[model samples]
Target chain A: MNLMSAISVALLALRVNLLRSVLAMLGIIIGVSAVIAMVSVTEGAKRAMEERIASFGANLLVIRPGSSAFGGRRGGAGTATFLTDADVEAIRSEIPGIVAVSGEMSGSQPMVVAGENWTTNVQGVHSDYFEARDWFVESGRAFTPAEVRSGARVIMIGQTVATELFGAAGPLGQTVRVGAVPMEVIGIMAPKGQSSWGSDQDDTVFAPITTARSRLFGYQFGVRDPVFTIYAEVAPGTNVSHAVADIEELLRVRRNIQPGAEDDFSVNNLAEFIRARNETETQLGVLLAAAAVISLLVGGIGIMNIMLVSVTERTREIGLRLAVGARRADVRNQFLIESVVLCVTGGIAGMAIGVAGAYGIGNLGDFPVSIHPAIAGIAIGAAVFVGLFFGFYPAHRASRLDPIEALRFE
Target chain B: MAAPLIECRDLTRVYRMGGGEVRALDGVSLTIDEGEYVAIMGASGSGKSTFMNLLGALDRPTSGSLKVAGEAIETMGPDQLAAFRNRTIGFVFQQFNLLARTSAEDNAALPLIYSGLKGAERRERARARLQQVGLGERMDHHPSQLSGGQQQRVAIARALVNNPRILLADEPTGALDSQTTVEVLGIFDRLNAEGITVILVTHEQDVADHARRQIVFRDGRIVEDRR
Candidate 1:
């Protein structure tokens, strides 16, 4: 038969047994939609991570004290806290690519202002810490270099803190009292959203490290001239690894560490951090893709099974067609078209459901889900391939039957 | 004279069973001219059905020259045989064999589907044949909705849809009641009288008696021929 008639006949056959045809297509639907939903969600998460890495200054290197052992007990990272002001100053003066360096101390405390009390994160840093972190004041000014020599009781409030402590009145020129100490809000820091680690970046108050050490957390750590963490921003067109090595060498020399002894400090760069996270995400993406492939395979086998049953059930009809002069190729094309039409229809439905499912999951769980236009083409192509691969044997069998024997079949 | 619609010479069909062979049609030769109403009668396994299969070009003979419409059917390939059947032979089966859930027009037009005809032309030819068989009013009725007599008539219309050289009927009335059988046989008589060659293969003597010529087979060979 001609192509048009063959297609029409296949469609008619499928319509004749509508329930069975849909049931046969179910495996393909589930398989395709599951893959699509999983793939889009994975893509969404990867993009989110990349954007988060970009949000923070990409060239910032975080320097902190390494773990220390005392009396056979090893302490956690940053517990040693041997980093001093001399080491920070030497790095600031010594490193060539160090555009900005700031030594910071942070603590969590409740601040009260005019009968309003809110517990939030507080950071103590040099004024240049804003430049290192790519964070700047939206209004007012940062404290100057002279403020470090004589501790100043001044603070800059983050967007969240300003909103919490002063409501719509704004926190600029207001007094935020921490325990018995009162610090004036010199600035409102620009807004920064959630960090990659799922913490709010805008819920902090910034003060000078000299003031924080002499006034608030000095009693807690019991250290003199304590500078635990240092943020160093590398200039554009500078090699970060070389700068990191230079800082490590300068720190070792200033701290009087001999050659071949393990350094007491550790440097963590943002690129390495992102690489580690991406490795884990790539592994997860592969796992999800494998599951999707398997589901498609199972769907293909379902088509094969249903096509076989259909061929057997219609043996007599096949005989009648052959007797009426339908070529063997014509018979084969009819069954092939039926299978392809089944999968293509199922695949389209599956794509719609998958995108909807991805969005539904995204809304419910507060995660990202991105759907690419190319995924639809892939779904349809995969479905046609599956139909052809699985439907061939049954169509061949139908075409090879002996017309006389088939007609006589009960 | 024009070539006979069907010609057979030394026609034989052999089937192999476990360690044995059964000759279904053994060296039987026959000719059927155009515009003849002929019946070949025999009991089950008497080779009447085998002969009909060869005459319709549905089965190849083991050794013979069988021609239909001036083409040597036994020497034809599978595709050629299919085209030969489409253009030259029409078949009516004992069970009617009308596709269920299909309208009478579509069922009758089945042969034209393989003839490379378009939908409009196929429907037109099928319509004419259905009207010829007196089923013009019920053209849209499905097989399930038609009576046994009407169903058989629909099958007859399907047989004539291709305007073939001969109509091959294999126990065409076997599934019908006595009244329906009479009605179906009457349609066949009218078609044959209109200059279309008809071959009826059955064991019922009364059914064979309606034809102008009768040939009886026994043990894969013809035992009697009467005109």
Candidate 2:
């Protein structure tokens, strides 16, 4: 039979029982929609991670004290007090790719401003900390070298602290009590929003390292000018891997570690963190893809079952067609085409549902969802494949039926 | 003299049932010329239906030479036989097997599907055949909307849409009442008068009387042939 008539007859057959046809298609629809929604969600997560990595500064590195082992008990990472101010100075002078270095010390304290009290984290660093972190003062200037050296009672407040301490008022030149010490606000730092870890970056105050050590957090005995973490920036056009290697070598040599012994510090590159996050997203994508595939497989099996039932129910119809000069191939094609049309229809509806579902999830959960056209195309192709792959057996059986026997069947 | 349209020489059809063979058509030989209205009369298990099946090319003879429309059908492959049947013969069943809910024109045009005819041409030919069967005014009506005789007329139109030289009816009026049976028999007589060969299979003597010739079967063999 010609292609047109074959399609028409198939459509007529499907329309004879519209409810059954739709029920048979439901599996495909759900499978395709799940795939689309899952892929879209993962794609959005990947995009969000990339943006966070970009915001965190590609050329930055964080140095922290390594885990310490004492008397068969191991402390967690960043528990040792091995980082000191001298190491920051040595790196600034000795490393080739070093652009800026800062020694950081942080602690939480209650501060009162205009009789409105709020407990916030206070971070202490040198003048170069702003440059290394790509932070800028929106209104006032940063602390000078003299202020950092003399442990001046001056500080910079982040946007969140500024708003809380003095709403709609100038925060500069205001006095805020930090624990028991009163300090003047020197500048208002620009907004940094939230970190990828969902911490509020703006809910902090910045002070000179010397002031924090002497007046707030007491120094560790026998460890001169100790700090918790050190932040650094690499010069542009410098390979970060080589820079990281150089920093690692410098710290290892200065810490007097034996050859083959574990180092007392850890050097972390932002790029490494970005790569790790991307790997995690890839793993998540794979898991979602597996789920989608399983759903599709189930849907394909449903199609096969329905097609078999249809073939058995229409044995007389098959007989009639065969007797009317319809080639066996024609009968097979008609049934196969019917299945494909059903799946294609389901695929289209599933796509619509998936996109809408993705949007709904994004809006409700405050995450992004990106529906890639390539993924959509693949989903539809997979649905069609499912139809053909599952429809073949029933169609083959129908084609091989004996006309005489089939006509004799009730 | 020209060859007969159908020539069967000692045709035999055997059915295998549980390690035994039952001969459905036992050494039956028959000849039918063009433009002859013939009735095949037999009781159940007399092999008249098997003869009709062989004539329609719906089955192969176990051993014998059976030729239809000057072609040896026993040697034709399944596909070739299907094409041959599509082009050379038409069938009307006792059930008046019109597809349900399909328009009369489309039902009549069913056989044309195998001919690879375009939709417009098939529908036009189907319309003309329906007019010939006195169903032109109800061409768009579905089979469910028509009477039993009207549905039979539609089936006849479908059988004739391919313009086959021979029309094969296997108890065409078996499902119809007496009045509708007469109406359908009148259509067969009219087509026969128009020089198209018509074959009818029935046990009713009145049905057989409508044909110009009659053949009776008993024990898989023809017992009588009368004109």
Candidate 3:
């Protein structure tokens, strides 16, 4: 049959059962909409994490104290022994491609200022700590070399501490008791809010490495056992693996570890963290895609069910057309067109609903939402394919019907 | 002087039922000329309908040769037969086979769909045919809206739309009142006068009396050939 007749017949079929057509198409709409919406929300979450990761300077590399475990319980809180100041000096003096290295020893400490006390994390580090972590002191001044040499009792408060301890007056050049030790506040750090790990990073304090070592932990190099963790930042264009190997070699030599002995130190980078997160996102994407596929199958089943009923209903019509000179192919084409039209229409409706759903979720989530063209294209293309694939058997059945038998049927 | 438009030699059709073979048409031979209004008359189960079906190319003969419009239909595939039927034969059914919810014009244009005419051209031709069948004012009206005689007229117009060489009608007036039957017969007479070969199947004597020639069949064979 010609294009005109095929289209007219399909239109007539739809018009005849407007409500049934809509109901049949609802399945496809829901399937496509759910797929698109779930994918969009998951993609949005992934993008948000990537952006947070990006905010931390890409050049920065963190030197923690343990190897990253695979599928094991997370390494946290005293499992990895605290690294010492000697480790930091050894990397600075001996290791090549090491730009800025600072040993950090952070712990939560109760602070009091005029009886207004709030607990906050206390980071003890050298002057290079700011440059190493890419953070800056927003007020007063960071600890100087003279203060580190003298082991002066001066501290740098974070924004949250400044606000809680000093109120509206600001805490520059004030004194706050750090665990019953009165330390003069020298600097205040800019707010960094929560880290990507969801830790309250801003509610913390900073102090010189010497003061924290001598006063808080009560240790001084070999004479007293010292406990401090080290953070090292690799230089630009330096291979992190090479830097890590170099640091390991230097530490092994400095600590006098024998050859073939296991070294007790760990170096981590942003790349590893990003890779883990990416793998997690990839799994999520696959899960969502699989769910979408299942829904599409359900939609296709719905279409097939409806088309089979249509074939049964139009049995006499098929017979009459055959008797009046319609070929089997023509009969098949008519039904196929009907099925495709139903799906395409459903796809369009699904797109609308999906887009609206995405917008609603994006606003409710308070995160960025991306509506990419490739997603819409995939949805529509998938819908059409589902329609055609599922609609085939019914159309074939209609076309293969015997004209004589069909005509004789009531 | 000219070769007959329809010719069948020992045409036979068999049906398989309940693990047994039932011959619907044993062996039938017939010939029909152009512009002839012929009727195949018989009671129920006399194989008259089967013979008509084979003649119209709506069914394939299980055995024997059948030809319509000088083409041997016995050797043709379903697709080829469909094309041949579209090109050379028109069918009128016992119940007017007009599509429900479709305009009379569209119903008439159904056969032309196989001819691959454009929408406008098809509609125009359908309109002209409907007007010729005295349904000019009811071109856009649906089958349910029209009377039985009007519906049959639309079916007849659909049959003639392709300008087939032969019109094969099965029980054209079987469901109609005498008045409507006479009206349908008047339209058929007019068509036969216009040199369209008309073959009608009917048991009603008054319906058969309208035809220029008639044939009686018994047990799948022509019992009497009267002209």
Candidate 4:
């Protein structure tokens, strides 16, 4: 039979039992929608991670003290202060591609401002700390060189700390007591929102590293001017790996680590972490796609099951058509076309539902979700494939039925 | 003389039942000329239905030389037989096997689907046939909406819509009342008078008497042939 007649016949059959056709298509709809929604979510997460990497400075690197073993007791990372001021100075003077470098020490302290007390994170660093972290002062000036030389009790506060301690009033030039030292707030850093690690980024204060070492926390035994971590920025167009190698070599030489001995610090590439996160998202996307495909396969099985039942139910109809001179292929084509129509229709509905679901989820969760055209195409194609794959068996069986027996099937 | 429209030489059909074989048609032979109204009368299991099946090209004889419209039917492939049936024969059944929920016109146009006729032409031909069967006003009515006699008329219209030369009916009026039976037989008589060959299978003598020639079957063999 020609395509038009086959399609018409199939449509007639489906229309005769609309409820059964819809029920058979339900599996395909759910499968396709799930695939689309899952893919969108993964893609959205990947995009968000990329944006985070861009915002956190792609050329940034962090150097932290390595774990130290003493008397057969192993200390965790950053437990030993092997890095010193000389190592930071050597990295600045010796490293060729270094753009900015800052030594950073961080601790939590309760601050009193205008008779309001709030516990907040406090970071001590040089003037270049803002540049290395890609942060800028929103309202007031940054600390001057005199502040670093004199170990001045001046500070920069973040938006959250400002809101908590000062409320609606301007925090610049306000006096806040950090632990036992009274400091003047020099600047309020721009809002940085949340970190990728889910920590509040704008809930901190900053001071010169010299002031923090001498005033806030007393020096430990056998350590002087100690800092926890060092932040470095590579120049634009310079390879971060090359810069990292230079810093490692310079630090090793300055710290006097023996040849063939482990270095006293660990150099970490920030972009590498982002790339790993992307890899994880990609793996999750693949896993979700596989699950969706399995669901589609299940839906295809549902189509096959219903088609087989339809063939059995229409045995007498087949016999009648055969007696009226319909070729066996005609009957097969009719049923196969019917299944494809059902699946394609379901695929369209599924695409709409999936896109709406993704939009809803993205808005509700405050994330980005992108629906790729290729994914939609794949979904529809898979639905069609499922239809053909599952429809063939029942159609073949219907085609091979004996007209005499079928007519007598009652 | 022109060759008969249908001719069978020593036709035989056997069915396998649990390692045993039962002969449904035991070397039966017959010839049906064009434009003849012939009735086949037999009790159940007398092979009358089997004979109708063979004549309609719905099944092949196990061993025989069967020809319809001067073509060897037993040698034809399944597709070729189907095409031959489309072009040369029409069938009416006792159950009036009209497709449910389909309009009478569409049901009548079913055979033309294999003919590859365009939709408008198929419907046009179907409309003409339905009018010929006196169901012109009910062309859009589904089988469920039509009475038994009207449904049978629709089936007859569907059979004739292909413009086949031969009509093979198996107990065509078996489900109708006597009055409706006469009406259906009248249709058969009128179509036969129009120079179309009609072969009907029935056990009722009254139905058989409507035909000009009668053949009776007993034990898968023809016992009497009379005109």
Candidate 5:
């Protein structure tokens, strides 16, 4: 018989045993749905991780002094600190890809404002700090370059510090007492939310580096000039490795480190860190996808099991058809068609359910998901494969049945 | 003279039952001409059913030659034999064997599907045969909705719809009442009268009596062939 007629006959047969057919295809249904949902969910997580990576400063590099990367250390990590503003200037002048650079002097300080006191982290920075951090004034203006040179009493308060210290009344132009010195809040920073490590990023205060050095913290205990770290933002579309090489060479020359002598600083590439995290996440996604495919395989086995039962149950019918005139090929094709129909139909249903389930997961949780159109084709292919794989043996058995015996079967 | 519609020469069938073999139809020979109505009768395991299966091309003989319409049945492959059966033979069963829940018309047209005829022609041919069997009005009725005799009539219609040269019935009326038996036998008689060769397998003397020729089998061989 032609394939079209065989398919129609198969459809008719499945419809006759509608409930049993559905039950038989249930494994394929769950498998396809799981695969689609799992893939979409993994993709969603990857994108979420990418977003967090971007927020974690994808283009920013942190330069820490006195790191263990310098070999022959006398004391600990802070023992070899010799970072200077002149070294920072040489980097700013020498590096081609550096868009912004800031010398940081950070300390946890107890501050009081209008009878309210809060202990908050405070960083001393350059005028370029806002751009380097991708932070902007949500309401007020930032400190000028002149303020850093003059050790200005101006400060920038983060959203958390602003809320905690001032509440409903805004903190702009308010006086905050640090130790015995008072500084005016010049800007309320745009909220930065949480860091990739889950720390509240919007809980710090910012002031001019010179002001931090002379007023509140005196000098960084182990580092020269009270500056402990430097932050650099690479220009967009520029290769960062070359910039790192140039900065390292320039810093080595400025610090008078000879060849074969280990340097006192470490330039940490944030992208490498994010890439490592992303690789781990992608590997996990692959694992999840494999599990989904396994379930689909299990579903195929279910189809095979049910198809065998169907052949056994309809032995007499098979005998009657053979007695009428159906060839063995015709019989085999009919059953194969039936098995394929069951899988393909179930696969389609699973795709619909999976797409809906994926989006539902996205909406119900923090993870975001997207449907890939290729999944439709993949699902159908998988269904056909499963149908053929699990169906062939049963169909062969049905076709091989002796008409005389089958017809005599009760 | 045209060739006999069916001819068998030393036809034998053996079944491998566990260790030893059972000679089901041992060294049997028979012939039936066109336009003849014949009945084969035997007790259970007397090989009458086995002979019918061989005649219907549903089983292969272990030895000797059996021919239908001059085509050797022994040498034909499975697919070729299936096609031969489709084109040359029509079969009826005791239980009607009509697919349940299918309308009488579709049941009658079942054989035509193998003939590769499209729906409209198959339905038309089936419709005419149903009418021929006096079941034209009940064409839409399912097997459950029809009486035993009517169901047998539908089976007759299905058997004749293919316009086969030979009509093989294996206890076609075995499940029916005496009244329905008479009604079904009448249709076979009428079809035989219309120049179609009819072969039936039965143990009932009265059922065998309807045929123009009767053959009796005992111990896997034909013991009697009489008019």
Candidate 6:
């Protein structure tokens, strides 16, 4: 049969059972919609995690203190005895891909700024910390290397602190109290939204390492010499895994670990972090795809069932067509095309509904939803395959019909 | 002037009925020349329908050779037989088996479509065929909307769309009124005059009389051949 005739016949048959076709398509719509929605939510989650991991910079590596014991406590005491500024400097100098590194000392306290006070966390770091973390001042200038050297009480506040301290008025070059100590806020960092870990990442202030080490707690080695996490940036285009390996070796050697002794440090790179996030996302994606496939399978079974009924109902018609000179292939093609047309139409409609449903869920809920083109293509392709696979029996039966027997069929 | 258009030698059709056998056609042999309007007359159980089915390539003879338009029927597969039927023969039925849901134009267009004509050309041919069958104004009408005579005329137009070498009418006027039957018979007479090979299968004498020659079957065998 010509393409036009095939299309017309398929369309005419679909039109003849318009209500049934729509219902069948609704199954596909729900299936595809679930696929799109699930993928969107998972993709949004992936993006959220990646953004949090990325805020540390593409070449950034986070070094956290690994497992440690103190006085046989054998549990976390909000401090670990391992990581230090020397380790950070050693990595920066020895690691080939490492460009800059900084150790963080975190302290949370109520800060009073110009008669307004709010409780916020403060992190003390070297001057190179801004470059290593890809953080820059949104207003005014960051604390200079000289200020960090002199242990000057200069600080950089996040946008949230700036807003709370000065309201609509500018807070650049203002003074804020940090644990009964006054510090100069030379700059305000730009707003970084909520992290996947449910923390407002920018709701804090940054102070010079010397001042935080000397002025606030009065001693450096007070609590098992535990400070904060160390962050370092590697050079661009450098293999992160290689950098991680090099950093691990350097830390092990510096810490003077004996052979077969476990190192007391952890190095996390962008690739591993992103891989971890993607692994979770991929699991969720598979789950969503399976659900969509189940619905599509059910829809396919429904089509097969309905087609079998159609074949039985049109037995005499089939005989008449065969008797009137229709080739078996023609009959086969006609039914095959009908099945495909139904599925394709259902797929399209389902995709549309899925997109709409995704958008609705995204807007109505806190979950982020985004429609991806690859997912839509996959859903539709799967739907078509399901249609063809399940539709075979009925189409074959119709095509193999003996005209004499079919005519005689009641 | 030439070989017969259809030739059958000892054609037989056997049906297996629960370990027993029934012969629908037994050793039937016949030849039909081009442009010959011949009728195959028989009672309800005389196997005329079986003979028509065999002659139309809708069924294969269980034994013996049957050739139509120089093609061997027994050797042809289902697909080949279907193509041969589409290309070389047009069948009319007693029930005027028009597709119920299709319009008259679409029904007529079916054969042309099977012949691989494009939609525009098929529609044009269908339109002309319907017009020839006096359904010009009823092209869009469904078979259910048409009278029995009109439906039969549409069926005839559908049969004629591919310009087949032979027109096989199996009780073509059996379901029509006498007046409608006469009108339909006039169509066959006109088609015969135009030198198209026409084969009519009927039990009615008047319907059989319209053909130039007659063959009568009884108990699955042709008992009389008259011209």
- Top lDDT hit: 2
Model 4 docking grade:
medium
lDDT (10s digit) by residue, model 4, range B27-141 = 9889989999999999999989888899999999899889899999889988888898899989999998889999999999989988999999999999999999899899999
In order, the interface RMSDs are: 0.8, 1.0, 1.0, 0.9, 1.1, 1.2
Model 2 misplaced stretches (Cα beyond 4 Å)? A2-4, A58-61, A66-193, A200-250, A269-291, A359-368
Question: Which residue segments of model 4 deviate by more than 4 Å?
Answer: A57-255, A275-294, A363-367
In DockQ terms, which candidate is top? 6
Query: What are the per-model DockQ values?
Result: 0.65, 0.54, 0.60, 0.59, 0.53, 0.69
Candidate 5 vs. true structure, TM-score: 0.75
- The first chain of model 6 has a TM-score of 0.82
Q: Report lDDT (CA) for all predictions.
A: 0.87, 0.88, 0.82, 0.87, 0.86, 0.83
Cα lDDT tens digits, model 5, B1-227, are 88888999999999999999999998998889999999999999999999999999998999989998999999998888888888888999998888887899988988888889998999999999999989989999999999989998998888888889999999998999999899899988988998999999999999999998999998899999999
TM-score, prediction 2: 0.78
The candidate 5 chain A region of ten consecutive residues with least summed lDDT is A68-77
TM-score per prediction, in order, is 0.78, 0.78, 0.78, 0.75, 0.75, 0.87
Q: What value does the lDDT take at residue A195 in candidate 6?
A: 61
Model 1 lDDT, full chain set: 0.87
Candidate 2 per-residue lDDT, tens place, A1-410, comes to 77777778877888898999899989888889888888898899888777776667658888877742222324555455568899999989999988999999999989998779889999999888988888888888799879999999999999999989899999899899998899999999988888878899899999999999888887453588987888999988999889889998999888877899776777888767776867766686788788788988998998899999999988887877788888888889888887787788788888999899888878987767888889769777988899899999999999999887777677
What would the DockQ be for model 1? 0.65
The residue-level lDDT of candidate 6 at A141 comes to 85
| Top TM-score model | 6
- How much is A216 displaced in model 5, in angstroms? 16
- Candidate 6 lDDT, A1-410, residue by residue in tens: 87667878888888988998887666666776777778787887777666766675667888877552222333455444657767777777778877878888887878997789888888889888888888888888888778877899888999888878789988877778899899888888977777655798788989988788888756546444345778888888888889888888887787777879766667776546566756866687788878877887788878888778878888887887887778998888788878878887888887788788778877886666766779768667867786788778898999999997787677
